[model samples]
Structures are given as structure tokens and as C-alpha cells.
Target: MITIERVSQVPEDFLVDNPEGGAFYRAYGRAGIPDFELGCFIVKRASRPVTTAPFFIMKLPLNTMMPPGFLKTLLGRIALRVAFVGHPSADVGRIQGEQSAEVLELINSELRKLAPLVSYKGFDGSLGLAKFNKVIGLPVPVLNLPPDYWNRLKHKVRTDLKRKLKASAGLRLLETDGLPKEHLQRVYELYRQTCDNADIQFEQLNVAYFRESAPLSKYVLYFEGDLLIGFHQLLCSKQIMYCKYIGMDYGKSRQYKLYFALMLQAINICIRDGIRQIDFGVTSYAFKRHVGSEMHQTFNYFQHRNAWVNALLKRLSFLLEPDESELR
Candidate 1:
């Protein structure tokens, strides 16, 4: 037998207990985005007493001009489906063990009761989510650091890293708990520019998120004299260090190769700390691959509450989701 419990706020100890429940999700919950509610689904099974997954419920807006009638309700449903066509309520946790399928189905079944559609985003493909729906191959590049890390890299990569490090003579890399309010605002502007230029668009981060989550993780800031040219936010779990968020000034990026330099710095940090893997997040595949990173596939599994909508999604899944080519 299985039971499910939904709560508006997750307990503090829950995050501490689960390795998957990290600062990113906790910070996202505190971001206070309007119409978005953060909650967790607790699944209790006969074999395992408790399993929890955090999710974001995004409320769809109704058209004010629509009169209060059957037509309004009908249009509202359509609008909701369309608004969340590509994006569904996101589940941010991993399901492990032999009963993983049953556990995932239970969580999805519960989520379907509240939202018309639900998705588990960016999970490991090996977890058997493909049985429920079409599993897309969304791979993220990761670089594994061996004991003799620098020598393990290709000769070209090692040469470039050294050259970039030497060229970044005046640039000082500072590891701090957080940036000042003004510096965060500047970083936000740079982040906006980076997002605007991206081929893929997703959630936008606010300054509040940066401020609230600063103490939980390490921040690496690159300064060219007094000006902040770039910054990288890192989150560590066990042996892996996730490069969660990064932003760089375009003008300074080319001149200083700020992105590559920051990446090299992250590698050095990982090697020193004995962190095995550095997850370089999605996108910029070519550069990441060039630097001896191996790609690991991530999957997003989704289901719709409505049968007709679900059928439509099965046929047009490519159109509804992000194009894989866009990343390349």
C-alpha cells in the first residue's frame, strides 16, 4: 500500500537529510515568484517508509474579458494547457530503489489531481522514467577530475588553460559568500543579456534568489581591476560540483576569455578539494566537449491529466518541448 501527502512548505530537516534536496531548490522556493507555489509530495510505501519530492505549481491566469460561464471555464482550460504546453509543474528530486516506477507513478498521479500536467525535469535517464512516457535525451556535459587532473587533459586544452590564466593577469578571482547588492544588480543585468542571447529560454532568476542562497554555496567572482567581469555559483554534493549559474560581460568575455578562465578556475578548485566531477550544466556543448567533458543524458518525463490533451502531446512532443538541435 502507498499513501501520499502534499504540503505547502517542506521541513528544514528534510532537505538536510536528502542529498538531492539542495540549495538550488530551497532558494527557488524562497524566490517568491508570483502565481508559483512550492510544495512537496511525500510518498510512503510498504517497503520504504518515506520518499519526498519537491515541486513547483504554477497557476494559470484567466482571461479577464471572458464572462463567468461555461465558455469561460472551457477557454480557461485551453489557456492553461497552452500556457504549460512546453513547461509543466516541475518535480526536483531523484527516485531510487527497486520500486522507483511505482513511486514515480504515485507522485504523478497525485500531481495530476491538482494540475492538468506534471513533469519530472532533468532526471537521470537510467531511472526507468521512459516506461511512463517518451524520454528525451537531454545530455549535460561533465568533466571528471582524476588525481593528476591537469596532465589528464588534452595537450591543446592544457595549453589554452595556461594561456588564458596568464592573460588574466590583472583579473582577480575572489571566492566569497555573496556579492553586494549593487554587484548582484550588475550581475543580474549581465545574466539578462546572456539569457536574451540564448537559443533556449526558461525561467529567469531574480536578485533575491542570489541574495538568499549566497551563504549555502560558494560564489566565484572574476574582477578586472575594480569591475566585475564574470561570476560562477557552485553547488556541491558528495563528489560532484554543479556549476549552477554563471554570467559574464560580453565585452570583457572575448578580451579576457572570462568563461573559459572561470571554468579553469572551477577545475582547479575541484582538483584541490578532491571533487570528482564538475557538472557544466546544459548548452555550450562544443566548448564543454573540447575541454575533455563527457556527456550524460538527462530525461524529462511528463503526463497530462486530460486524455485528449495527453494524446495530442504524444504526437506533438517535439513541438511542445525544447528542440535538441537548439543546444548544439
Candidate 2:
């Protein structure tokens, strides 16, 4: 019997202890990091013990409309004994194991039934696995900036950095530790402005998120003074560092190449510390390419269950147009 349960938390040990499982689970679904709601399905047979698998779970703030009562009631009627709740992205669906022909078909059937009430999608291996004309992602590459690379930079890049350093006034580059409260507030302001310029609307992040992750993560940079002009966050393992989030005052400092300096600084730090790869995160941003970083494509997999909705989705997919002129 398979029982699905809504878990308040997906233990950290579970993710670290089961690398292959974690990778697999992340491929089909993500409960998301810290404080997001996640669900797991425990499968058991008459003789075998319980084994937890990533089934249908929600990340959060996305599928808030699907209440707990509705999910529980629906699951009870089916053979499924448990259900993970909430849409971390407002994307919901049923999750199964290493997707086989039969398993996908079965999932498709169940989704067909829930067609009217729910929509299903996921972050799968589709991106790395797909053969595309443009970009592809490998396992997050561990990178360190090569020594002397900075020396060979175009005269323009070097001049920009020098100019900024000279005029930085009271700008102090604080490491992840000892970052002051006022500093973060300014960084967040810069980040918000950047998002606005890009016409991207993001869930507002509270100071708590920055305060909590800043010191804990390996790289958190902030340029502080009258303005909180720059902020960057990096996530890392022993060998790999992900340039997770960054905010900067491009308008005020665009000509100064403050962002470039920040990126180079990250690379230098990584090299010094023996960190191998820097996953400058998603975005075909020109600066990322200028840093000699390659591009990787991440994809979303949407599977609609109902015949009507499935048909509806196919048409919608056809209508899907590239939102940007160049995906960088």
C-alpha cells in the first residue's frame, strides 16, 4: 500500500543522507528550501518495510487555493494513503518514481481525473537531458576564477573597476559574517529596484530570510555606506558554489563595473579556498557570459491529467512564445 502524508518538514538528514534519492526527488518535485511545505509518499508492501518517495507535494504560496481538507478528502477515496499538500509554485501534481512508460501513463490517468480542480507541473531533469539548439545545464559546475584571468581582462573592465574603487567613498565590502542590519536593508532596496527594472515581480522577502541565510552561507557580499549598493549570496558544498542571488545598483554604478568586481571577487575567494565550480545561477545575463561562464537551460514539465485539460494544454503550449528576444 502507498500512503501519502503531508510533512511539515523534509528533514535535512533525509536530503543529505540519500544523495541519489535527493537528486531523483528534486528532479520530479521540490518541496523547496527552508519553511516551505512539502509532502512525501511512503510505499510499502506486505513483506517489505516502508520506503518514502517524492510524490505529490506543494512548495508553497503557489497553490494556496487547494485546502488541506480537499486534498485529504480526495486522497481518501483513492488507494493512495497519504498526500503532500500546498503548491510551492501554484503548480501541483502527482509524483512517482523513476518515470517509466507505465508510471507516467498511470500518473497521467490520475491527473486526468483531477483535471478540473488541479494543474500539474514540475522541475525535472528535462533541462539537462534535453538536446537543444541553445543552452544546456550540466550538474551545477564547481568553478574558481583562474589566476591572471583578471590581469588579461579588457582594459575597459579594469578601468571601470578602478574608477569604482576610487569613488566608493565609504563603501565597505562586508563578508557574510558581520554584515550590519542597515547594510542588508540597502541591499534589499537595490535588489528590489533591479527586479523592477527587469519588470519581474517577486514575492517580497523579509529581513528574516537575509538575516538567517547571510551568515550561514559561504558567500554573502554587501557594499555598504550611504547606499546599500550591492548584495550577493552564494550557496556551496565542498566543491561547488552557486551564485544564488545578487542585487546591485546598476544605474548608479553601471559604468563602474561594481557587479564585475563582485563576480571576480567571488571567483577569487573560491580559488583561494579550493572551491572548484561557481554556478552563477540561472540567467543569460551578459555579465555572466562575459565572465566566461557558460549557459544552462532549466525547464518546467507540465502534465495535465484530464482529456479536456490535456487537450487544452496542448493548444496552450502551442501558443507559448518566447517572452524575451534573447534568452540569456
Predicted structure with the largest lDDT when compared to the true one? 1
- Worst lDDT run of 10 residues, candidate 2, spans 129-138
TM-score of each: 0.81, 0.61
Best by TM-score: 1
Report clashes for each candidate as comma-separated counts: 0, 19
**Candidate 2 structure quality by residue, lDDT tens digits, 14-75:** 44532222432342233133443245433334534244334343222322212234543553
lDDT of each: 0.66, 0.45
Q: In candidate 1, what are the lDDT values of residues 224-273, reduced to their tens digit?
A: 88888888887776688778777888888888888877777888888888
Global local distance difference test of model 2:
0.45
Extract clashing residue pairs from model 1: none
Identify the runs in model 1 with alpha carbons over 4 angstroms from their true place.
14-23, 45-49, 59-93, 96-101, 126-131, 180-182, 320-324
